[model samples]
Target: MSNVTTINPATGDQLETYAQLSQGEAFAKVDACHDAFSQWKLRSLEDRASVINGLGKALRDNKEELAQLMTAEVGKLLKDSRDEVELCAAICDYTAANGPEELADEKRDPNNAGRGIVTYSPIGVIYGIQPWNFPAYQVIRYAIANLMTGNGVLLKHAANCTGSGLKIAEIFQQGGLPDGLFTVLVIDHDTSDEIIAHDKVRGVTLTGSDDAGRHIAEEAGKALKKTVLELGSNDAYMVLEDADIDKAVGICATARLYNNGQTCIAGKRFIVTEKVYDEFVEKYVSKFAAIKTGDPTAEDTDMGPMARDDLRKTLQQQVDKSVENGAKIACGGTIPDGPGAFYPATVLTDVAPGQPAYDDELFGPVASVIKAKDDEDAMRIANDSRYGLGGGIMSKNVDRAIELASKHFDTGMVFINTFGLADPSMPFGGVKNSGYGREHGGFGVKEFANAKAIFVGAE
Candidate 1:
């Protein structure tokens, strides 16, 4: 069983190679995890929290190294990588701090005949299948919370971040935790699927594309296992006539450019009202053109290359299709002059509904600008996608903003005054083709646990 290869997308350089576990090895890990889970689930929440606290400190201390690895593995800006590492550490800290109390029971009416208290308890091992874009951050959120609930974890991080994935598994082991309490199943897709399909896995958490999410969901459904899928998004950014044009432009740049536009919830479509669409477009185009794309390892780089050559080609094909369908590029639409998978930050305008760019998620530094006659049309255009994930609404009228946000059709979460800013306190999930279940806050804790209703005096 050969290991997965890790190549830097920016320079097409092989950074490090990781070995995939054999079929027998994968089964061995599951067996070990199950054995460990049998006891881990019996541990007190306080003890679990103490261990998680140790994990949190480890993350904080290794923040710089984690950031460097993150940038080297996936093509995101250096600064963004630093912040993502910090966020990972913070989530670990949060789980260690508030988890026990969050698991506490809520006030229920005691007038029910022979009623009792609701007790929250651990289930078993949580199998986390995360993507490469935000590798360290995503796994930490799932791991810390699961461990806090006294459950062991198995991580099958993306094929790209093998080094970081291995590092994560080692960190938990070094934090004085049990051997199988936190482990990484370094295996191929088939092997990983077999591991996830194992009965002892208990539950699964996935953060990836819609296609991959659907496959995992199908397998989990067949097993009758609980699954939380944070799937892909074709999010829209709506600009009302009364929106602060300059502020909208600035935030839009950051929202779409984050992760080199590889984010599932990156603002892909720009639905702007016609009255001020021109002004917004002027500023937005200017900002897009000014973005500096370069080496992800460089500290001064604002934009990094596409995560892989295949993804870059796909992005280029999307841009080509849009242009062929009569869409005009306002800023950039081609790969930059380099050996890496670097593409310039692109802005498309006059993107008619029939254009390829209008219907598909241009999963790169490409934003399609659509014209809307009014707020009604803006919301209409935003809700026209088959993918209902996340959305953004920039407006001056607070009430209208709320109303429009509430009225969005194919969206799960809508953000006002800014783009999608995910927080551990917020309930994060998607609707429609974007998949189901959440990965943050109280919702996340329950995803890995089986809620059993305890009733008494009825026998």
Candidate 2:
């Protein structure tokens, strides 16, 4: 068997190591989870809600320790890590309070003189393959929804944050969750594929790159299992002709560099109208250059190292290729000589089609600036990508922005005038190459549920 090591991205030091489970052990856990679901699905909605509420309380109580662990694992800023814990706690609270209604049965009209009832029934074990970006939130986002829907959860978290995944399972148990309700599988990719194909594992959910999503989806498809995929995106934030340039500059900078710019929904492409492109680029570059990068545990650090050294190298290569393809580095493109996986806040202008900066998702602290002819052209440029996860529109006219977002934006989610992440009350997912199926709000709990229709006729 292999071992998964947790390394501190901020300091380039090893923190802990976990032994991977053998094939037999992993399959046994899946069997146990399936057994738990058999019992869990019979529990009343009120009983499930009580356990979920307890999970929320436990998350709040251990917020500090979880936050610190996430920072160590993924190098996110300390404040951001804390906020992630808070978000996860809120998801627990929301799921516990609103899940029953979302999954309750509904009465439907019958055409043949019969009464019809549409019931949302629980599937069996759900397997979640999550990433390390938001260690707790990513798992909580899907796990809580599945748990609330009376499905047992199995997690195959990214190798870097193995400890975080195990810790979350511990928290769930401490919160009064029944044993085997949630299990963390410490296994490799081949083992994960086998688990997906297991008969008892009814569904699969993934949060990762497009390539990984496609592979997992293919595996799940072959097994005739349901899957929910949340992939990567080079989310665009457009600055139209009537946009507030100063405000756009500040918000755009923050959006690009948030979470050290590793977010799937972070603003990667800044599509600006030619009318205000010059001023926006000037101020945006200045703001990026002014960002402070240091230890993630520090209170005042603006940015931190990436989750791993290899990720930093990939970002550097993408930037280099973009520059070679005619994109100009405005500022902060060079990698600093350091022990940790640290890359400076980078901005690449003169961006166009065919370059990585324009064509791909740069999952790092690198921003792509694309110039458009006008507001109409800006929207066209933003929609020109293979990704449709999320995008933002910066305009002084709220009504116009809303209309554009409703009618023109091709993305699954749109931000009118701000930059943000997942909200407990809003649906979160993507379309096209960014993958399908919605999570968050009330959409997630039903993704893996079986909507069965029953009809009764008088004798």
Candidate 3:
């Protein structure tokens, strides 16, 4: 039998190996999940909420141990890993509290002919293909919402974080979830394709690259299944002439470097008005250079290693190509010789079109600086990208920022004067290549639900 190995990116150590399930075994698991969903969907909404609440408590109860496991598996800072667990628990809490109302039947008027009600009925099974950056949160963001909506969940997490994925399934079971309701599939890419094509799997959701999204979307579409993709982006943050340079530098620096600089919605490009370009670049470069990279378990360490050496190499190639294409490396451009997959925090200037730094998502600890003529030019430059997941604006004028976010920003979600990860109360998703469908704020629970309409005849 084939096997998948989990490695610690921080220490270059092998953690564990999981045997891949054969085709028949994989199908059996899918059948089991479908069977569980058959019974799970019959339960009352309140009963589902009770189990989801228990899951939230379970996450908190196991936060420390799970956080440490994630850090060991994915190389995220210990604190960040703990925070990720907290965010996952918060998602459970939010879904449990709001899911019933969000998925409740809505009374509707069918052209005044009769009374109509739209019921959000649970689908059978949802297969989630998640990445390793936010291990717990990625699974929780989709899995919890689906569970609350009375659907079975199947996870095919990144190979490097297999332990974290299995641990999550264990937590769900400990929280009173029924057997087979949440299953972790430690399988190969071919097996994943088979699982996606299985008749029992109802819907698919993926959080990964645009290419991966395209592949999964194609396969799922061939099966006549619905999909929700949260792909990649080279999100831009504009610093207007009226912006507070100091505050903008601080927030933008944090946004760029958060998650060891591997976030999809991270502030990769900084479009600054000419008035503040020089000052912003100076401070931003200094901030990037001052970042402390070391062991992720260290409490004072600000940055950690990339999740894998291959990922680091890809990031290095992107940086090299960008420099060859006329972008200047202002802060960090060299890969430090180390045992871990550690890349220094980097800042690039003179970033223009025709360069990877200007055109694509870096997906690492690299920031691209673009100079714009004015506020109008800044907004224009921000929209000049194919990927539009998330972006931000920093200006003292709150009204102007709101206006840009409301009408001008071409992305799905926008941040104003601050940087944030995700909020349970806010809808999170992207447009264009960044993928479609919303995740939080009550949109996720209904994504895979069947909206059945029941009409009453006049007696």
Give the range where candidate 2 is weakest over 10 consecutive residues by summed lDDT: 108-117
Backbone clashes for every candidate come to 2, 0, 0
lDDT of 3 by residue, 1-459 (tens): 688898898989999989988988888999999999999999988899999999999999999999999999889999999999999999989898999999888999897557899999998999999999998999999999899888999999999999999999999889999999999988889989999999999999999999999999999999999999999999999999999999999999999999999998899999999999999999999999999998999999999999999999999999999999999999988999969999999999999999999899999999999999999999999999999899999999999899999999999889999985899999999999999988999999989899998988765
TM-score of each candidate structure, all chains considered together: 0.95, 0.99, 0.99
Candidate 1 vs candidate 3, TM-score winner: 3
Candidate 2 per-residue C-alpha lDDT over 311-386 given as tens digits, one digit per residue, 9 for 90 to 100:
9989999999999999999999988987889999999999999899999999999999999999999999999999
User: Which residue pairs does candidate 1 place in steric collision?
Assistant: 3-19, 3-20
What tens-digit string does per-residue lDDT give for candidate 1 at 1-459?
Answer: 886788898888999877788989888888898789888888777778788788878877777887888888888788888888778877877777778787775444355546655777788878899888887888887888788777888999889888888887777776767888788888888887787778788888888888898889888888888888888777889988899999999878878988899888889888999999989899999999988889887777889988888888998898888899899999999876768889999999989877768987777889888899998898888888878889998988878888777764567788888878678788778898887887677677777775555555533
Candidate 3: lDDT over CA atoms? 0.94
Question: What ranges in model 2 sit over 4 Å off?
Answer: none
Cα RMSDs, all models:
1.9, 0.8, 0.9
| Residue 51 accuracy (lDDT) in model 1 | 83
lDDT value, candidate 2, whole model: 0.94
Q: What is the C-alpha lDDT of each candidate?
A: 0.83, 0.94, 0.94
Model 3 RMSD, rounded to 1 decimal: 0.9
